[model samples]
Target: MPRGPPAIEKPQLEAKKGKKEEPKKQVKKHVKKQVQPEIKPEAAHGESNKDRRKQVQKQTDELFASLDKEFPVNQMGPEPKQGPKTPATPTLMSSSSRPMIRNPPPFNAVVAGTAASNTAPTACRSAPSPPFPQPAPIAPAPAPAAAGQRDDEKRWDEQRWDDKRWDDQRWDDKRWDDKRWDDKRWDNRRWNDQTWKRSRVQDWRWKEEFERKQKEMDEVLAKALAREDAAAKMAQQERLAAEAHACMSQQAAMREEVAAQRAQQERLAAEAHACVSKQAAVQAARCLAWTQQCATVSREHEQQQQQQSDAPKMQQQSKSAPKSAGNWKHKNKPQPKNCHTNPGQNMRDGRRFKEIMQKNESLKAACKEAEGRAAEAEAKNKELQERVAKTAELMKKECKSGKDTLEKLMKQHEECKKELKERIQKLEARKKDLKERISALEAQNAKMKEALTNEQKEAEEQKAVKEKVHRNEDEQKKAAKRQKTEGPAKK
Candidate 1:
């Protein structure tokens, strides 16, 4: 039984009854006097009694007025009777002794009736729960016990109390059944049969996908590597081509320089030859002048000898005629030949002078010829010197030109070498980039494979959740579909 308040004794109820009796007696006296006056003379004899009644009525009315002044009658209602002073003993009642209490009528019943009259059939159909019921009272659960208490003991006690009248056999059977049940049986079975199969299929699919992707990556990498190799080969070829071109250019330049040097040497040789020829011509002129002087001297000597022989013949004839008388006179008067002089000697002398004059004229003509030849030789020599000087200047210019050309060619070769070096550097950089990219792709592929492995495991879990028993078949269908689509798309 539930605990109850202390019981109320009989003495406390009697005391309350005695407190209410005075007000009841006063009301009876006031009503009895008014009714007795309505009867005949015999009732007139009850005038005194009526006076007493009036007096009681007045007192009662005054008491009621005082009560109304203190506490209005309109505010009065039946007061709740106090319970007995002693605690009440608890009593257990059967279910049949207590009436089933229904909910009270709402204050808006008339308003609801009017609204129901006004509502259309369609409106009424659409309105859900038109007559709402009062909400039920919610009971709070018992508070938990303090720490150090056994929770199982507390729960057992509460259950025992709540089901106090329940049959022990039924309770034992229900408890036994609940205790024997295994909640995870279906989950474990489903995971072993269906989820494992799904996981296996998914793993196979993931492996195939990884293999295909790896092959694609390998193909792309190979193509990139081939392109890089081709670029490197092209660069090498260009470098060799540039080197060969530079070598050929150098050889041609050397040959041209040799040719120029040979031409300069030939010019110098021709100049020397011209100088020797001029010297020889001057010598020949001098020899011819000496021969002419010798011829002139020989002619002069021959004329002198002939003149001496003629002079002696004339003198001998004159001497044989007169030795005595005229000899003194011939001696004194001088001989006629002696006086006249020898005509032959005079003729010879004249011839000799004429010859000498002719010889001198010839010598003078030869000297003039020699002078002219010497002058011509000198002029030619001067001209040759000038030509030599001009040739030397031309050779110097040519040499300078060759030097400038060689310098320009060297600069061009240096620039080409530099360009080739730059191209090689670019090729090396491309190779390095391709190597790095391949490494990055490999890392990404590894990461993707790890993720796919995890995803396949998760898919197995999801398959169990979705209760898909034929997980392997579904996976195979999906794999086939993906293969078909991906194959066409790749092409």
Candidate 2:
């Protein structure tokens, strides 16, 4: 196999590969021994040396030819080496050595081309020798590091490679870093979204729990209110019952008093009946005594009549016989002076007996009339007592009915009071609710009024703007007309 150029294995490549080979050692020694910086010769301003100009032009062409084979170039540096004979062609160069052209071109281009041309100036009449091998391309500089860090200029020189290969490696590192940063950002966003979702769920659960608790509390309050109402109703009923009982007791006492009065009236009537019976017995005894006196008087009158008839017969017989003379003699013989002494006494006794008998008859007639009047009075008294008993019974009945009506009225009054109280409470609650509703409505009206006022202000501003625009347009129109008219006049 053919051996390649010694310039291919530069000391820079050995440092990058980190190899200790024999060829790399030999190359390092050779590079260290020939440590010279190449310089391009400048042209003189007024000299007319055609040979020197030709020599400089030839060296610059050879330098460009070797660089074209080894590396690709887009543009040359601003400051370039100028030749006296011809201008140097602008050559493309790698980034690492682009600045070095201001200092020196590489040793390979200088030694291979300029050395022979300068030494054998006369031998140039013959053809030139074969071209020297090109130098290897240099690597690009690395990107700037983090803050407080310096760019590694030496490392760039040590790892010299082609510009294309270095650009590919840089692009790969940039792509990897960008992908890692994007993944980290995406992960952080995902974590934030998860936390927000959990918070929302917790808030919803808490709201539901609060609503449930409120409902339970409301139900408990309603139950307590109902219990209180029931207790009030029961107490009212008990009070009514006690009132009824008291009324009944009062009625019983009244009935007892009425019964006692009836009993007293009955006893009075019995006493009056006994008095009438006794009066009747006394009247019957007086009638019987009067009848016996009248019968004895009649017997005495019959006896006296019989005695007078016999005496008259005897007197007629004696008057027809000698008894007449005897009676005259006996009468004459009893010549005791009766007409002069006993005549007044005998006459007074007969008159007094007749007056006493007439007085007894008048007294019996008066006693019978008095008995009849007493019987009428007793009958009138009995009628009055019966009427009083009937009136008392009517009064008792009225009292009992009155008591019953009073108890009913009392019960009705209690019921009405309870109903009125309930109505009042309901009305009060309704009043409160209506007041709250009215307040809310008034607030809404106020808000509406404010909104309407704002709208009116906005409308007024729009109207002013429109008016201003119209006035401006009219002014412009007038100005335009004046300009037209003035143009004709000036012309």
lDDT of 1 at 9: 15
TM-score of 2: 0.35
Measured with C-alpha atoms, the lDDT of residue 339 in candidate 1 is: 26
Candidate 2's C-alpha runs over 4 A off are: 1-223, 297-491
Candidate 1 residues 123-222, lDDT tens each? 1011111122232332344445444234433433333322221212222222222111211233345456556656655775676578668867876876
Number of clashing residue pairs in every model? Answer: 9, 1
lDDT of 1 at 61: 63
What is the lDDT for 473 in model 1? Answer: 30
Model 2 / residue 158 / CA error / Å = 13
lDDT of 2 by residue, 1-491 (tens): 11111111111322422432221110001112222233121112212223433565587568657765654343321211122211232222333211011122222232323332322211101111112224333224335554322312332222222222222222222222222222233334445644654564466446546755775676576557656766766676667767777667767776776677667667766766676666667656756765676566555445444554555675686577664555676455542232223446545644654764775677667666666766776676677667667867776787778677766867775876787578558756865775675577557546654654665465466446545634654464355435434533553
Tell me the lDDT of model 2 at 137.
37
Worst 10 residues of 1 by lDDT: 22-31
Candidate 1: where are CA atoms >4 Å away? 1-356, 466-491
